[model samples]
Target: MIGNGTAVEINARKGIFFEVFLVFLKLGLTSFGGPVAHLGYFRSEIVEKRKWLSESNYADIVALCQFLPGPASSQVGIAIGMSRGEWRGALAAWTAFTLPSARALYLFAQAMAAASGGSSGGWLHGLKVAAVAVVALAILGMARTLTPDRIRASVAAMAMVAAFVLPSAWGQIGGIVLGALFGMTFLKGDMPSAAAALPLAISRRVGAVLLFTFFALLLGLPLIAAMLKSRDLALFDTFYRVGALVFGGGHVVLPLLKAEVVPHFVSENDFLTGYGAAEAVPGPLFTFAAYIGSAVGGWKAAVVCTVAIFLSSFLIVLSALPFWNDLRNHPSARAALNGANAAVVGLLLAAFYDPVWSAGITNRTDFALRIAASLLLFCWKTPPWLVVMLCGVAGQVFM
Candidate 1:
């Protein structure tokens, strides 16, 4: 019933913004188990209980955000906030949902920095090993979902090769580009049937402007950072770019982040250590940026990185809201997304080999720990936070 090519009636009301903030903050504090679980929690809280939107409407929002880069759960929260209380609602939702995890990780980073031998500590190594298991599990699950056919499998394989050959952020970006090209050429399919239109408050013009701004910053930030040689600007650019380019949410950002930050902004141990600790937190995995930024330049850097990364998500979800009604029906868009997702699997695989597998498995004990962690993750279907704890204990005692 919300179908249209124009703005929906504003539902803005007094206290609605604060209401949205409170709801999301509650979710932030309790919604653990990664992005997928976060989605389920949202659907229950917003759609089922609160009755914010119909089932089909929520599905459409999720569908749109899932295809775009950045954390899908956070984007969905923003979209709902916008639909309910306009832009202020969107801001409230994002702030509340992200604050818990970001604050937790920032504190963790400070502690690690304060610890004298923290980098070489068994707990940190266990975190690294946890990252190994997590990434390995991510690739397997994603490959099954994203690389189902021979063509997509080949795309993933080629992406892995590209990541290895180039061995940098460019390589990862190239693989995504390559996947889009291959998808357009070979993965073409019939156009999708249209779905219920979202109750978007943004106009196509505003969405277009935001979309352009998103790309402009994406393209211009790096040049500006390089020209001015400003490390802070460069830091913002790196996190923003990673948030913009990641196809699959959550674990897909691992390799791209590792490529950019490892040895430059943060060491490999601190990187994985943060990632593993992120698993234990109760919000978006993108908050991992806060920890890395803290390690690089303290809380101010943490604030910059966190803002820069999530800002992309806000821009993208807002931009796409007005366009999704048409874009989601295009067969080519879907195909390109498929190819990009396949490339993500390949990227994860490459990450597994280098920083994940290579660094985590230094000896027979570590190798055995990897297998046990994998089993706990895959066969046991254990929660990742639990896995992190178990692995940390094992790494402390055995490793």
Candidate 2:
């Protein structure tokens, strides 16, 4: 027979899990705007209504997620869930938030597979053009917010040059590291007091284990796959590393994913097509992994790649959450994050020029279409999916 305390704990855990699932599932289905907007929705629901965390605490978590790699909004959501119910709550939040978008993209991939030849139509081209516009707008928006100061602006410029020159996973990682170092040396300013640190839900020991596991996978996965000589394992390793290392928002993953997938697992056209389709869907852009995986192999690959990408993100968030409060309150950490954020903006700008612009903006007509799409997205403040649909129709008619 269970003791009273044990029974109460079990019941409370179940309640927390279910609450996290329901709340995020709703957001996953309904959250239409990008990461910034998703944060607004999360604040409204979780902070205002549910009262899971205080405003300052939520802001601190957002700061930590922004400073680290992977999807920021998703990480924030996972952190909130963990705050409510530890690792289980974090898993619940991620699954509920990601499932709707992942399922939609996976099913769409199946449809695209069925209509293989049909995917190269004018509408698809329009989608590609729209993607170019979307990424451009993202870069502009992020730059405005992240690199306001001249010092930060310079860091962004340097990072952009490095990424443009190298155009590899290592390039991105190096850019972030350099940004942090620069931040520590040059970007230090009025730092937040350490007294404001939020309490950790998980202990330092657990955080250490999670952080250790993250590095172990990062370093060991490729070697393990090579030893086993498994193509599937290698694919998983590639996607996992990409997911683990990407800074900025979901769009930042574009160049990284393109480098990893195109000419190897999938064609360039197919990769761009999936990216376009991702814009038309709601929820996190990371779900684009599902589409890429499905296009390359089938549902099996889809499942594997999707899990691989998101699992890395999950591990990173879990590892960081337990120690984020202390990190954020430190002056050095704040300075490093300032530089890192600006560097991320630079990385996005480079991506916009390369795979996004070069691949999508082919002719004068494509350029004109992208310009119009940009106006719609930025000037008109149109919804992305709607903009995607209009662009698709415009592509069919014009391009």
Candidate 3:
């Protein structure tokens, strides 16, 4: 409510809601870098500069969101908004965080229809590369904070490997489940840090009922649609399954999407092109469902698909986030989280190899370009958006 010099005062009830909507609107518009970069922006703007939450508290919220199933950065934004304002704030946060990228993606999908594959491919490649680096940096940065000791480090390492070797979702689920179990069964009653522990306002019973109701609706909505044999079922099914199943983040859903959409009617080449285009646009990867729906099912399908996917994503995020909060606060849960974190690393590594590295880094020039781009991102600190732009030009000229 209070900022330096300019004091914009409103009733606390309305003020928080407006602030959430406005802040998220700005974030949605300007938030350019992938998830990690988005995190950086949030930390700098909201945490450090705005003093909305302490760095530790902000990070705790982020950790909780990361372990959830939807877009991590967006969820973090929502959590911040909610923490500051309440459910209305949470609504504002999600809308602001998601709307910009979603709109941009809609434009990108339209552009792809007119442009040739060769012309737009490079920038898309660059964006993917940049995305990969951003995710890696995020994992590393998060690890530095989350894993301070050998035990935690070991947990992270194990999680990473498990992600690579088994399914990626395994690591994510493992982290949350293990973190919770460890906390409940083993970790003793150690209070959460002051910033991280807001006093529980809702009754425990009420909270449990609400959480259960939210998830029940989440699971039931799509099933209900399916039973009715809705025309939008495929789109809903795909989006719901993607929302329900995939772990790590939006990028990880590419493979699953490929498996489902490609064989049905969407061309492999077209799918990849759309995917690359999706990477270039802003918002959650799940929004790609919009493009897919538009292509296969028309505008109505696109609408249905977008709603289904977003709802599925929103529900999963809601269901999983509180549990993640509990895990981080509890000691024993922290132990299992250690392993799960490592598994996330491993899964990311695998993603780098399969889709990002293997698929993108094909030729010698492509390989060389990747190295140069990585250097630019990691060393010289060129902006990722610029890197993506340059890479696109490079892709047009060369690849």
- Best of the candidates, TM-score: 1
| lDDT (0 to 1) per candidate | 0.88, 0.84, 0.61
| Residue lDDT tens for model 1, 1-399 | 564422343333547888999999999999987788899999999999999988999999998898899889999999999988888889999999999999999999999889972487787788778878887877787888888999999999999999999999999999999998899889974365448978877899999999999999999999999999988899999999999988777888898998999889887777878888998889899999999989988999999999998899999999999989888888888888888888888988898898888888888888788889899999999988889988899888987
Output the number of the lDDT-best candidate. 1
Off by over 4 Å in 1: 1-14, 190-194
TM-score per candidate, chains pooled: 0.94, 0.93, 0.73
C-alpha displacement of 172 in model 1, angstroms? 0.4
Ranking of candidates on lDDT, top first = 1, 2, 3
lDDT of 3 by residue, 88-152 (tens): 77777877777666666655655665576322466565555545554455556655755556655
Tell me which of candidates 1 and 2 scores higher on TM-score: 1
Lowest lDDT block of 10, candidate 3: 181-190
